[model samples]
Target chain A: MTEKAIEISNLKKTYSGGVEALKGISFDVEKGDFIALLGPNGAGKSTTIGIICSLVNKTSGEVRVFGHSIDKELEAAKRCIGLVPQEFNFSQFETCKQIVVTQAGYYGVPRVIANERAEIWLKKLSLWDKRDTPARMLSGGMKRRLMIARALMHEPKMLILDEPTAGVDIEIRRSMWEFLTELNEAGTTVVLTTHYLEEAEQLCRNITIINHGEIVENTSMKDLISRLDMETFVLDVDRVPDSLPDMKEVSFRKRDEATIEIDVPKEFALNQVFHKLSDKNINVLSMRNKSNRLEELFVRLTEKA
Target chain B: MFSKESLIALQSIFIKEVTRYFRIWVQTLLPPAITMSLYFVIFGQLIGSRVGQMGGVSYMEYITPGIIMMSVITNSYSNVVSSFFSAKFQRSIEEMLVSPVPTLYILLGYIFGGVSRGLLTGIIVTLVASQFVDLEVHHWGILFFVVILTSMLFATGGLVNAIFAKKFDDISIVPTFILTPLTYLGGVFYSIQLLPEFWQTVSLANPILYMVNAFRYGFLGFSDIDIVHALILLSVFILSLFSLAYYLLTKGIGIRS
Candidate 1:
């Protein structure tokens, strides 16, 4: 089996005012695994990433990357990991090419090699067209892409992206997701944190949801979605009934004289509800699922927690 | 966890910072030169015509080294303070904090950057001051030693200020309320010999006074206090400030959060 790309165990972090940011959290990422960390606001996602990247000092725990302890062999471990933060943090005066090349130099890449790698990554991210422009002059989406190019210049085996698509438009967000998917497919271990549950659902095979500084769920996406059996279907009918069917496994709401919304568990087949409506002589006009499997799973899990 | 690669990272950051300040030489290097020239014209030329000699040297020549040292101190301290604090404010310092580069390298990188600008501005001011007065250096070795050491000491001081500074205003508070006052009282314009006996004793406690006098002694071959003691005191201050700055950086104080 391939080695574990990252192993974090019993991590705990307490700020100065006794605020517990991470309370004994633990997880592992296998080589080439694409995992999404889903969480709400103030859920310690940033803290976890910060500790792994050695930006924030952990109160207690062990983090290992590529079988090397971060505390003991920080440089060796860090050399293999690249982090793209949520905010724009590059020097305002530096051009996109300069930012990437300088970051490569920090990892000991020779200047010529760094330049080559920077060019390749910038081109891959579609940022080569603006290579000479100062980073501060770039649009928000371009700056985000520039950050990703900079992070990739070192050719790290593992990449951690915190909200890589936040604040981006739909078209740009989709392109970024596609680009990251390609990167992961090319054998890089990817760890992502994002507020968009749909993005996580579409990209990640495995997921860990953090809330209140603790991991509420860590499992395969299939398993998590399967566990949330609730699904909703909105139906348009020819007419409204004076009273709805009293099915224990399903709930229905009348949208208007001709539309109704029904929520039912997966085990209770939709065919049964349709059969009941047919028996009542009500014609079903149209139907659609109100939420995707992943949305249902996320809402159920977070609400219960 | 020092490595060849980490040193390369330090050098990259140092070079970037040096390029940043020098790229805007009109703002970073010109202002000091102009300010020092005003001092030479006002104090050395206008005021010195009536004050005559100080410490057995012409008044213009007596204050030349002190003014140059003052410029070096201010520039060195401000360079790091402003640059580092701006990095903190912009949240770009996280780039270095997250990298494998050690904290010592980051500190040294900033210190070297500050020292470069400080020394460069000092040289320019010195050249400018020479046009106003016939300056003579009695000991080039002492002069060079004092200039470099004093620049380093203040550069380290700037790092400390940057680490503790929480806001943009915090950066100015020290240079204005503390550094400027200590510098003026440190005998940049007049020899400590002219102060009252009690004030002279109190002036001995100010570290900048030693730096100014040591630098002045290098040029004039005379000092109100022992130059050897001044050198030792300045060395101790540099070591202490360096240690404090390094400790704060490694602990991830202010920069990490």
Candidate 2:
């Protein structure tokens, strides 16, 4: 049997102003699984992570981290989890190396060992060169990566990152994704909350979507993506066409002389569209998804919730 | 919470707190040393020449211990209050809160930072006053006791202040309006014997007065309040403030939200 990395049952959180941030949501993550928690703004994603880290008190329910009860064995539970918050919470005056070393110290790593691990993590995250510089001096991307390095320093069993890639540029975001993928591959159970749906699709094997303070979907990524009923693709053609050709089981429209868009339902094979286009003697240069499948599903699910 | 790992966690926090204050020495360490030197110059030499004797001792000598106690109280209280409040404002305090470090350790770490500052300032001020007023050591044991206890007491109060404070103004309101007044009227420059009987009774209510008088008693072997009651009151305030600060910390009053 697979062990559960985190087991949250009937979790609820209601702020003092009577705002119900979470309403009895429950889910379980198998050990070593990479997961994404998707939600719209004010949909209680942060409140849920806050409760998991014990930053926000739960109104009701139970949370256990790696089988350690947060309420009863708080120290043990906290020891197994490291949190990378959505905002930059580290001190501006401290150097990058000091931040990570101090974090390791909080988890009871000896100073010598903590320093060694800090060096390793900072080097791995491409921050070793800037280790002596103050945190305030680092660029936005470096700061984001600094937070990740600090989280990884203690080697927690589960690393929870809340919008870790927010505001990062595309190139750096992809690099961070690679690093996190590598970290997850090293057997750390990773749970990420992100606004980027494509990142979720690329990195996560398990998917949990929360909307309106409730879990709308929790299943394997394969199952969730399979539930997507239709996908739209844009095909770039080599030659200009006077008019577009009609096709079966697909909706086609010319976006421009060189580009055409098509909606292909799950019932039709994409190869059939290519076969028909070839039969019409249209030279296709490239084809790409008009919209990311998970994105469309995310919008549809969150809009309904 | 009392395990070996907790001790290491405490040591880490303590080191950070110490490093922070020392790192900003101009802001943290130098100001108190400069302020106390100015006090010795203006109050001891310039004013004591005219004020004559107080509490059966020269005005300069009589005010020496009181001045030192004042520095300890003010510096200790301000140190913890400002440092902790800054951590809250920057949201860096969440580092310790989310860790396995116990709440008691968090409070102790900040208090020690305050205590260290208080004692250092007191020592520097005492040395500065020594050059102006003839130094005397009537009871070294009581001198050490009063100085240490007074620092601990105010450091705990500062922790409570920091825990409840929501904004920068919240942190200053207590020290400015309440702490300054209490310290001034606590007889740092004059003896309460000059006051009317009823005002003397009210002066007794200020906790700083007890600390100052006990410290005064240690220096000149003379004090308006009973030394025994002063010790008892100091212990009580320490216990109460420590308990309240610990409770506020565990409750996550202003820091959590």
Candidate 3:
């Protein structure tokens, strides 16, 4: 039987100042599965990640990684996990190569093997040419990539990244997506927490949304998107209409001279809407989903919580 | 229990710490040497010419061991304080926190690094002192024992200070207000024998006096304090300080949330 990569049971954390960060939330990530952990600001995402990585002391919980309990077999659990924190936590004085190799050494990899892995990972992340430069000298995107290379140095079975591409440009972000997809395909369990809902829809197979220290939604990506009660579509028309079409279970708003937004319930049919528009003598130029489906569900879930 | 993996982690942490000091040699190494040289020139020559001999030797020779001990004490304490506190401030210490390295190995790694800097600075000060006076070790075993143990004690002290430090300024407060005052009054310039009966009794309460006199006995073959008692006191202090450092680290005091 395959083992779960991470299993958090009733995990909770209260800061020294009496702020309750995680209020008994629990979840699991299957081995080799790519999952997105989505939440809004101050939603306890980072606190949960920090407890899993042993960076923050959990007030009470049972967290297991690959069959090892974090409290009883902490060393074993830690050895299997690699963490890319939300902030840059490496020394600014050290070169890129030094930072990655040093991380391998922390995991007990020999210096020779660490050097080899550092080179390969840096090269894979497109940072080999800049390996000798100090970390402070690297651009924001390069710094993020350097963090990824460092996280992969020990060849961990699971990689957890917290906002790894927070400030990266679109080109670099897409490249990172491709890299993460390739890594996950190679049997590495990846748990990502990101603000970009579209990226989560494109990359993760499953989703878990948290708010106010509670788990509000957890399911497969396909199922979660399908649960949306209504979807808004933007239609570009050939010309502005003089009057609106009277339709049941559908609502329309005039966005502009050439654009109209229509909200279609899950029970409604798109063909009937097109026929009604045809009857109205309004030619639809093109149509597209108004916003990311996952985003819509995320907003509703967090707001409801 | 010591495993191969933990050994590697210890070596890595030690190497990283050493590299930090070496990388900033001008700031870490050079200053101690220059500071001790000034003490030698001003106190050992300009002032010693008038003070005559001390403890059955020339004034310059009497202050040499004390000067070396002072450098070791300050450098060992400063190395661990600055390095560990900087790691905390930059949040780089989380690297070790997230890794599988045991807290024992991490503490040992940093303590060894501080010891290395302390000994190196001691040797540099000794070399600078030799230019002014012919230096000889009266007892090589005692010399090595005292210096090493003294460095260990102060390094552990530095670790405790670092663990309690919340800011860069916090690291300096101990060194300036506490460590410096104790070192200066700890019989570096004058033997406690020169003090009045009451002050002499009071000097015995200071811990740095034992380290300085123990180290001084290694050089001149005599000390105002008993060498055996000095060694015993140094060992106890090291054991106690190490326990405190280990406890603080395991509790995640300053470096962890």
Q: Going through the candidates in order, what is chain B's TM-score?
A: 0.97, 0.96, 0.99
| 10 residues in a row with least lDDT, candidate 3 chain A | A239-248
Instruction: Show where candidate 2 strays beyond 4 Å.
Output: A239-243, A269-282
Give the alpha carbon lDDT tens digit for every residue of A1-305 in model 2.
88899999999998899999899999999999999999998998899888888888899999999998889998899988889999998989999998998888888888999999989999988999999999999999999999999888778999999999999999999999999899889999999999988899999999999999999999988999999888888889985576666766788888887888888887777777878788778888988875589988888888887
lDDT tens readout by residue for model 1, A205-276: 999999888999999888887787678888989998988776878897898999988889878878889887
**Distance from true location, Cα of B139 in model 3, Å:** 0.7
Error of 2 at B106 (Å): 1.0
The Cα local distance difference test for each model comes to 0.89, 0.88, 0.92
lDDT by residue (B141-242, candidate 2, tens digit) is 888998999999998999888888888899889989999999999988888889999999999899889899989988899888988899999999999999
- The positional error of residue B236 in candidate 2, measured at the CA in angstroms, is 0.8
Which ten-residue region of model 1 chain A has the weakest summed lDDT?
A291-300
TM for every model, in the order presented, reads 0.93, 0.96, 0.97
Off by over 4 Å in 1: A234-261, A267-288
Give i-RMS (Å) per prediction. Answer: 1.4, 0.9, 0.6
Residue A83 lDDT, candidate 1, scale 0-100: 89
Interface RMSD for candidate 3 relative to the native interface: 0.6
**Candidate 1's error at B187, in angstroms?**
2.0
Q: For this target, which candidate reaches the highest lDDT against the unseen true structure?
A: 3
Mark the 10 consecutive residues where model 2 chain A has the least summed lDDT.
Answer: A239-248
